[model samples]
Target: MALLYQFFTALWELTGAMAPYILFGLFFAGILHEWLPENFIRKHLGGDTIFSVLKSTLFGIPLPVCSCGVIPLAASLKKEGASRGSVLSFLISTPITGIDSILATFGMFGWIFTIYRVVTSIVIAFIAGIVSNIVGERGDKDPAGSSASPIRPASFRADPPAPGQAGGACGCDGGCGAEAERGFSFFEAMRYGFVTLMGDIAKPLFWGLLIGAAITVAIPENIGEWLSGYTWLGYLLVIAIAVPMYVCATASLPIAASLVLSGVSLGAAFVFLSAGPATNTVTIGVVRKMLGSRSLIVYLATIVGGSLLFGLGLDLFFDTMQIDPRSVVHMEEHGGWATLLASVILWGLMLRFLLPPLFRRKRRCEGEEDSCCTKG
Candidate 1:
């Protein structure tokens, strides 16, 4: 019973700490969605030069999208004539570091850790982009050998997409033009920021919090001390667990924090953070389908190898500098009433979007025996 209480307390604290920043991040994302030109990304990212890759990485870093959401966006970029390297860089950087994730990292960890994560993510993405360019075929052949034409337009479209048409996959439902068509009103931004973006992240964030609380309760307090003796083993163990998992960058922060609280090395936690959100089985298959097998290989190799090397460097730096992960965790800023308010708003949005629709479907199934929900 006491353990259960502690677990809930920890979960609430973590949620409150992250809620405000997440709301802020989502608002910025909505603003970007509304204001950025329809052809902004496609126009700048289609070239075969290193500059294109750098632009892609930079563009992806602050965008709020996860691995699952990035697939369709990357597909759109590919369809619009983005180089394979630029696409790969966008894929690598976007999911691993975002405005939401960066803010959450700062809320849970500190400025130094947050900066490390962002810089390392960019470096890893750059390496992957460069490697993909070197190994990838430069022609207009799709992965399945279909010929694709470059779709660069001479001018940007001022009007947004009509209703029901899907937008660019930056985790926005209506895309860039959707809001523009509606005059980019405050209410529209609020809906996208609080509702659409919340729906996108709610499930993953829920699971992340649950798992983080579970790890807090399950792992012994001295586990870190025991694992400290086997540093490389810890790194490998974390990588093995993180590589195929689908945890989002923002959601993974609390879990990493809990792991650090349980005595895991910062580097080991860093490994999990680096690989967990960016690379998953579905993402790997999607990359293979989008780029060739060679680009896929380079993508996987860069993330895996770069994460390990960066993880080792972090550990060495911590040891030499006498920095403590626990101290960083303790340094996290505690939220006051605003955080609590944000948490309530976030939960309300999640329930409205994630649960009520299912209940409605179930109710409809109860009324109609031939309903698709009943059939399924």
Candidate 2:
């Protein structure tokens, strides 16, 4: 089908350049998954108040989770007894930035904007989390309502378990078995993380690729032209459009840059940049259950409000300071080799991750336990 081809092409393009970073990010995520404890998340974050929200926001800031990856992880955190505020904070913070995204962002938008993004995201997530808690129920209430939490291995805690012990190895029911002893080594954990991330995201990636390819091939003209004259309205529209979309945080960056280059207002681009990957429906539902309805309201308000205000502030700053944003595109010519290299690296990483399991068993049989495999 034409649609199917478009989808695959899109997938290839989106995943083509940055696949390696994504893989490495997954590996680290698994490591943290093994090392971190759920009880610590619960004890420290189990409160419907400002302090808990701040704690979660701060905790989420440096971790390198993107939109597609954050959902299950946040849900898992909630299932592990993390407070609604903490979950809310994770939801808000996870998408806006991460280690992979930060590097990608720095590459595209220079250090100043990158720094602005990280700082602003943290501040916004914290404010949103705090507001959610204030508007939501007390901790004593039925924290687990209509929504389902993540399936956590029972041994999860804030503190890392003993060196030999697996953190959070208790399957959802807290029963231990022989399977539990097959602790995942770092490489194994990394592989699992990559597979898990792919499994979780493949659907969205398929859809996104289809849409992106259509936009690139069929809609080459400037799509934001209609709102070009009305800067503020255009910015709001960006938020509305982005909230329901499932683009990755970093993938959205180039598109945002392209929009900005096309005479779209910086504010509108900022709206797209911030909202495109952050406020999708999955996160919305997560917010509803984790923060409670009232807190969800606050969370949405914070994102929408914060984005608009920030956009406006940025616009004024650029104008008042006479700061002209450099072009998102570099040379007038394309970087063919750069593109090819990026593609090879990305695809190579993906293939390496997807294929190793077929051969890794031999290493295991040879009595070589991979230290790189995570044990969570």
Candidate 3:
């Protein structure tokens, strides 16, 4: 009974620690989505080996997409004629992390581990793109050859707005909307950014918190400890399990931290950190269909190969450097009150990010109903 109470308490505290930042990250992600046009991405990014890979990584890094979400984006890119190489690079990088995931990684793994995670994600993305371009056979014959028109013509301009079809108040449309026709203002843009962000990220933040709590409660400490002894096996287990399981980078960090404290090998935790986002069934299927079987193989190779190599390096670093694993674990004993206070503040901030948008949506629906009733 005492164990059960302790588990629930730990779970609640963990959720409080992580939910706020993820909510903020989601808003930033929405702003990026609204601002970044697909045409711009296609024009500069597609082509020969090196440039394509670089652009793919750059474009993919900050996007809020998770392992499941990467599938549709990669597929859409392929449909829009993004080179197989660029698509592969984006696939490798997209699931890795963003601002929210990075912050969560820091909260869980500390600074050094987070750095390694981000750097490795970039390297894997670039290498995957380049290698696919080099080794994979180009599948389709280009009917137009060099004369084929690029997806976006250089002279083409975006469609002009209709009169009175004012721009969305959310400055995300770059003053191209009806509001710009009336008057452009910076404060409106900022307002839009904040509101749009609240709408988009609230669901994921809620889900992440719930999942974090469940893992904290359900998993036993000894399970993690037992696996630590077989570090390599632990990595393999994480890979095998995580490959089929879908988890975003930010949400996975707290669970990894808990597992680590429970005695799971750090190497295994790193594997979960890397592979959880990179290779999943949805991402794999999309790669196979859009990029072809060969590109799919290359994508898997990149993530699996990179993760294994990094995991081994981490294991060696911990073993040879004699780093104390216990130092990473912050239990209730040391600075417990401080940790609790911080956790509460974080949860409050997350609540602010999540609740307002829901209220707005409800109000909007109510207004629409009132208008319909009046018309009737």
What's the number of clashes in each of the models? 0, 18, 5
Over 4 Å off, model 1: 138-141, 145-183, 330-335, 358-376
* Total backbone clashes of candidate 1, pairs 3 or more residues apart or in separate chains: 0
lDDT of 3 by residue, 1-376 (tens): 9867866777666665554455556556545544555456667666756977898887777766665546645654665566778888888787788766876666656688878888888988898898888766565433222222222211112223345643222122344211222233344333433443333334544565566556666778687566756667888888897777676777677667666666777777788878887777876775676666777788888888888898789878887989866466444342456555655655554576666665333432231222111000
Give the 10-residue window scoring lowest on summed lDDT in candidate 2. 364-373
lDDT of 3 at 17: 53
Candidate 1 Cα lDDT to native: 0.76
Q: What is the C-alpha RMSD of each candidate to the true structure, in Å?
A: 6.3, 6.9, 7.4
Candidate-wise lDDT, in order: 0.76, 0.60, 0.63
Alpha-carbon RMSD, candidate 1: 6.3
Indicate the residue-level lDDT of 289 in model 2: 60
Comparing 1 with 3 on TM-score, the higher-scoring candidate is: 1
The TM-score of candidate 3 is: 0.73
- Per-residue lDDT tens digits for candidate 2, residues 62-143, read 5545675566667666655666667777787777876556665655566777787777788788887766555565553544
TM-score of 2: 0.71
